[model samples]
Target: MRSRSSNRFSRPSAQRGVALVIALVLLVLMTLLGLTSMRGVALEERMTGNTYDRSLSFQAAESALREAEALVEANRPTPAALAACVNGICGSPNPADLERWLDPAFPSPPNPGGWQAATQVSNGPISLTPQYIVEYLGDTFPCQPGNPASTNDCKRYRITARSAPGGDRSVVMLQSVFATD
Candidate 1:
């Protein structure tokens, strides 16, 4: 019964701004989701970078350990000569001496007391060349069966190596023992 023109133009007053409100709410939710995802991605990136730096430091320390072992094998240092620790070779570690490596001042100052630079190159680039120290742990006679002591004994050396990533963000230390006849 109503005219066709009037029906076409009729709209509910209550629904006037409903569509706009809905659109604005959706936009806000989407923005929040985007920001949260971005934060998660950034955190993952930082974690990955730290892991890489730590792995590099570990490899560098290992290389330094190998170099120190080679030195001990080649030189076959005597206990008497180790007292002076010439070129990173050291005598038995006293409590104070053992703590020296952990000291912050000892490494950067380049103390000649015991630390030695690694001559071998690492697989990856490192900010600091690794350093190591070889400590004479006395003699052991592994070949002589049943006899705890023997004149034919092998010299035992404990080598400790340390390396740090760029900016000193991370540090790695490794220890190994080498025995030579």
Candidate 2:
């Protein structure tokens, strides 16, 4: 039998650097995995930020809509001008304006002819200024008996409000109808 000392160091030389090579390969693969994970996280963060901006824009639009409705309600004494409306419905996209507020295909400007710039809205806080139009839907039939004094000369108004976030292409549009006294 061979001496114990001779057998102890007689292992194959080819395996000497195999462990080191395996360790380096593993390290490279782990680094690649880490980079991929980081990229995914970054993308998610961007998406979340966009969602927040969209929310803000929608809220602003809703606020504008309420304001327009209130204004129409306040005009209780005098009747709204129907001749100024586009087809007697859209106040801004009137026949004289270059852009049509009611048309989705048209890129509506904030200040179309008869459109009134919204007041009580902070221009700096909101991305886009809100605009409103008061359309007068002609006479309405009496909802009750044939009493002339009881007949209500009700007028209909259509209000449209738009809001958008800064640096984002997304926009929010809100529209509502209101009846006058």
Candidate 3:
């Protein structure tokens, strides 16, 4: 009876810091989770910014190409001018003449120094600058009336424009053709 009473009176040993350890572990896990979420958000923002820059660059390039094509069409030189040239037609107006036609008075110069001249249609000319790079590909092959391979007297031109917005570069290409009818 005495022994039983003594045992009942004895206080149970305290749970040695188990609660503290659990609390610390939980805190560490929560901190890690928060940090990971923060990192993910930051990465997403960066990606969005980059995408926007690329989009702007591509738009600029496309605009440049369109301007160039219009210039080519407008400045188709005389048949004599196209004949003197080698690449396509020396007697007809060439890309160089087209470049010259780009009015400097415009807000942006269509054919800056970066504009390159092509001798033949093939890859055409390329322009490289700190702000952007453009590639113009022209085709003078006339299309055939009946046969797909055969060419008529029409000429085709393609221009590719590439630009970098805030140093983030992108490319845009455009193609067009003119007939001597």
Candidate 4:
């Protein structure tokens, strides 16, 4: 009869480290997954910060626009002064005269020729103060052809406001038309 030791179950020496190799592979995969999720979270955080900054810029621009409108309502500038664009009140009536407002470089550093800085009392975190420009779009006559003598002549004005936050990283601009009594 054969001895029990002679028929004992045994593994090859080469396969002794198989379990260790499998454990190492699993550990590497887990580490990669964790790193990927961390990157995703970091990206989401940056996006949220950008959104909030843009919202603040837009609000600052709107406040400047309202201030310009108030200025126009309080004291109307003469057409001659507006024609010369004195103190940011422009009445040139030429569409090209207002082209500078669209120029990215024009307002970033501020052009003393036309931009008017707003005195907005900001209670939030904003990088730069808002600014505005006023353009007179000429007078509008409400009288029809048959009623040429109608006394209602309204002066139309276009107000443009801009805000640059984070050193021009984000810029917000707004425009509105206002009529005077």
lDDT agreement of model 4 with the native: 0.74
Query: Candidate 2: where is the Cα deviation over 4 Å?
Result: 1-5, 8-12, 76-82, 85-99, 102-114, 120-128, 141-150, 164-169
Each candidate structure's TM-score, on Cα atoms with residue i matched to residue i, is 0.79, 0.66, 0.54, 0.77
Better of 3 and 4 by lDDT: 4
Worst 10 residues of 2 by lDDT: 85-94
Q: Give the least accurate 10-residue stretch of model 4, judged by summed lDDT.
A: 104-113
lDDT of 2 by residue, 1-181 (tens): 7755666667766657888999999999999999999999999999997787677667767877887787677763234443444311343234454544556444334434455555444435545565555555444744343777775766666677777323544677787767665
Q: How far is candidate 1 from the true structure (C-alpha RMSD, Å)?
A: 3.4
Candidate 3 error regions (>4 Å) = 1-12, 77-113, 116-140, 145-152, 164-181
Best by TM-score: 1
On the 0 to 100 scale, the lDDT of residue 126 in model 2 is 48
Query: What digit string (tens of lDDT, one per residue) describes model 4 on residues 23-88?
Result: 999999999999999999999999998887787778889989999999999986646523655666
Candidates arranged by lDDT, highest first: 1, 4, 2, 3
Q: Model 4, stretches more than 4 Å misplaced? A: 1-16, 96-98, 104-111, 120-127, 141-151, 165-168
Model 4, residue 59: distance off in Å is 1.0
- For model 3, residues 1-181, the per-residue Cα lDDT tens digits are 3544557778898789989999999999999999999999999999997786555545555565555555557764333333332222223345655542243331222343433332111112423231222222234555565767765555444343334222334433333344332
Scored against the true structure, residue 53 in model 2 reaches a CA lDDT of 66
Q: What is the lDDT, from 0 to 100, of the residue 31 in candidate 3?
A: 100
